[model samples]
Target chain A: MTVPSRILVVDDDADIRTLLGEYLRRHGFQAEGACDGASMRERLHRAEFDLVVLDLTLPLEDGLDVCRDLRTRSDVPVIMLTARGAPIDRSVGLEIGADDYVAKPFEPRELLARIRAVLRRTTGKASAVRPEATRHIRFAAWTFDPTARHIVNAAGVIVALSGSEFRLLRAFLEHPRQVLSRDRLLALTSGSDVDAFDRSIDLQVSRLRQKLRDDAKAPLLIKTIRSEGYMLACHVTEPA
Target chain B: MTVRVFVILVLGILFAIAGTLHATAIFHGPPFRPTLQLSVLGICTLSLAFITARMVTRPLRGLAGAATRLGRDIDAAPLPVTGPTEVKDASMAFNAMQRRIRANVSERTGMLAAITHDLQTPVTRLRLRVEKVEDDDLRARLIGDLASMSDMIRDGLEWARSIDVAEPFGRLDLDALLDSVCSDAQDAGHDVVLREESAAIVLGSVSALRRCFTNVIDNAVAYGGRADVSCVVDGARAIVRVRDSGPGLSDHQLGSVFDPFYRVEASRSRATGGTGLGLTITRNIVVRHGGTVSLRNRAEGGLEVTLDLPLAGAE
Candidate 1:
């Protein structure tokens, strides 16, 4: 029989740790809890955990340090939990190689869904319904794995991407070389439920542009279509 | 300096000699025609001598030493009461004012602590009770609504009792603070990035400035998906820009964004709850630091929140 996926939940809050452990166990996964970085290190020594659910506000060592440290040693997918209400922290966490993130006071079901999604993406068992699964897009000497939610540069260095950036890039990759209007991009990425006046997508693009090192003066990968929105002026090859 | 003093003394002596001459002429030599003028001149000479003596002996003797003592210890020896009645009274008043300020600050801090502590139990109890509600949607909605109240209570108490809300002047690294803020947000799963990452230092209350930035950034991320932070240092003032790609506020709604409990979007229901105090608290903190916060919808689409603060150590 295949071993149940061992998930490590690291959080300072005892209640949250217990709650997540109970919830994850109910979802057909083996779960263990660690209150801080010290305990987390000991737990890691004991056995290999498939995935780690880490909180940013740990006691001794901060969550970001743990993330930076963990990424260096292993490819174990980590989903960070942050209480800070800042969007930059989220992007930074991803940039540091956190596989996924969920803000605090998050619904248990959403957390579960994210866990499952991360696991499926890592294990190459993602649903066929993900349209980008069949497409492989290359831009600016970077390879974007939409199914895996991973971006690797030419030297095979994993580039960190926020959730919004991932989604936006995926949209761009799917319709490569085609102009995607802001309204259309919003509809495709954030769904119609998004606020009408939200220019968040534009900011996300700006952030993504920074990561890609795309110059505003002369862009190569993602170019402004003007009057339209942005277009991914790149080559895409579908998975065989 | 010595020449000026000598010249002042010489002028005094000259005036005194002139007064003696005029007085002698008035009393014995010849009947003085301008008796009133001569008497006025004599009085003026006497007054000048008295003023010069006071300026040289009183303030000049003790002013530097008094300042040095005050700098060394806030509770140092009181200013000497030997100068003049007016100066002595002023010194006494300064000591009394210092004592009063200390007492008032301590009293307020204690009151804030008491209030904050008093509030936590109720909020905790409410949170515990909220967990027991079985209806998923109603429970979530109730909790969401309650969160705002709790946040408001927390912020209100913190604001009311903050010791450094009116902080003493000090220099701060504005650039480092912004960078740290951005880093903190980046750690929180936000898509916020510092567009212009340059180090600039300014003089202000560190905590108050932090609170100000936190409020503006929180509003941007909670309402908008991402925030673009930029700071432009212009001489003695640093203009901080926090631009968000959220739903841009209407021109009419822009004015009221900083009003407490005034939310521009009606759809800020349980899912995304804000106390509507973010902007208000932000503006308050900034203004307290002798800074200003302005919100305007960018012509290119998005809302830009600008914070103008006096640069630290700038003249």
Candidate 2:
């Protein structure tokens, strides 16, 4: 009764456009292809898409320009296809409101996984996963300041979190006491593209656990729920 | 008028007036007053010349000093454009020339960055395609080759970044920085020891300078078995030496070792993997901080990498 989530792929390469479109369709998702900014605009005007897989390099109009324009006009979630690996370019994409990015010549499956993750985060459903309008999250002796995107330990020293690591930890903090299945975490961390089995989630969880130092003293922080999934076994509280 | 000509003309006029007054005094008054008048004229001319010479040379000396500095340091502070209009114009032109040179250099660096960026798409594509190969051994080999290729390209790009150094400078502790780097190397199974006892404050882009020291210690431990790092302060500069016990480079290799990707592996072991740009980028970062990086072979069969950075107070 309900149409599947629609994704728009905007790329200049025709082979990539067709191949990627077919790949997404075979995976049971609807996809539309656009060559440049004008066609992308027409597609958006015709119907709303769940997410946009935008390439930073285009024929006529620059991808970043289109992304910046898209941010001002619509609330559509965008995942940038960047060829440059420079951190400055990545920061610029994030600054212009791109939800995520995948370097070009990327595996089509990787792109699909990212699209799904971005959609899950952008669609209204994600608000329930990430508490809305909260500034601070506290668990154990660590304080999570989402605005600064930094974690401070008991000594009040900041701990560095790689991008995926932060996303995984934040997901756990948000879904405290609830066992999060690998598939759910895969969607949460967007680390499921090449990971066929449970490689990504298991690796990310163990990494997060290590950073959290979840041991006998902090035993209940993150617990392996046997064959079920992973659970942040502690209470997640917000500063009043 | 030129300062010299003006001084001469003023002196001439004053002497003419003084001669006329003395003549009038001698002709109209006592003969005994002539000596006093001559002495007065002598003192006036001598004092006037001394003051005028100093006034003319002071600002000119400043301009000359600034010109030589501008020749050596492209980013030297502009000559104060606040003197006479002619001097102001000259200083302003010099400042403009510095700005133009800086802009030109940055533009070239940007072009290099853009070209290096072109390598990424194909590299990423190859990596993905390699992952799909059915042969396990072949796939693993191709992936490893691709990764090294990627690292090499990244080193080229990092070299460009070091040249630009867009990050703002910050004051950092030399001791803590070395401690962290040594700890990281040790964690990675490299035998690196840091003398954390010595403390020096330096102004630099923390990440850039950290990358420099990391590269040095990495090269040391990779070629040599262990790395011993020590920091010392000497006058206006802080010196850090990373010494390793590995086989040192020969006389010929030492000369070109810091050349991008220049490797001494021809005579030494081939186990180490590097894009060759490590030393190149390290040197660029150190030079940007008004520092120097030098490599020398230790008599005990190893290499010593020494870096000298200007202290914050010195800067």
Candidate topping DockQ: 2
Q: Is the docking of candidate 1 incorrect, acceptable, medium or high quality?
A: incorrect
Model 2 lDDT per residue over B1-315, tens place: 387668777778888888888878867877557777788799778978786676666667788898777654566787777656766777788788889987997898788778778877667556655655789999878877776776767777788888775666766667656765665566466788877455577877656777898899998888888899999998988999999998788888889977976766652333477877899999888887888899899888789999999988685
Chain B TM-score of candidate number 1 = 0.62
User: Which sections of candidate 1 miss by over 4 Å?
Assistant: A1-7, A10-13, A24-30, A35-38, A50-217, A220-240, B1-11, B22-28, B31-134, B157-280, B291-315
lDDT tens digits, residue span B71-190, model 1: 434345666665667666766776686567667756775675466545544453455456668899999888776677667666655455333335544555566567556655774667
DockQ of 1: 0.03
Native-vs-model 1 lDDT? 0.69
Model 1 chain A: weakest 10-residue lDDT segment is: A190-199
Residue A62 displacement (Å), model 1: 8.9
Residue pairs with clashing backbones, model 2 = B224-B246, B261-B276
- lDDT by residue (A70-189, candidate 1, tens digit) is 767667788888753334466677767776787654545567767775665555423233334224456658877543434666654444454466667877876678999998787556
Q: Which candidate has the highest lDDT of all?
A: 2
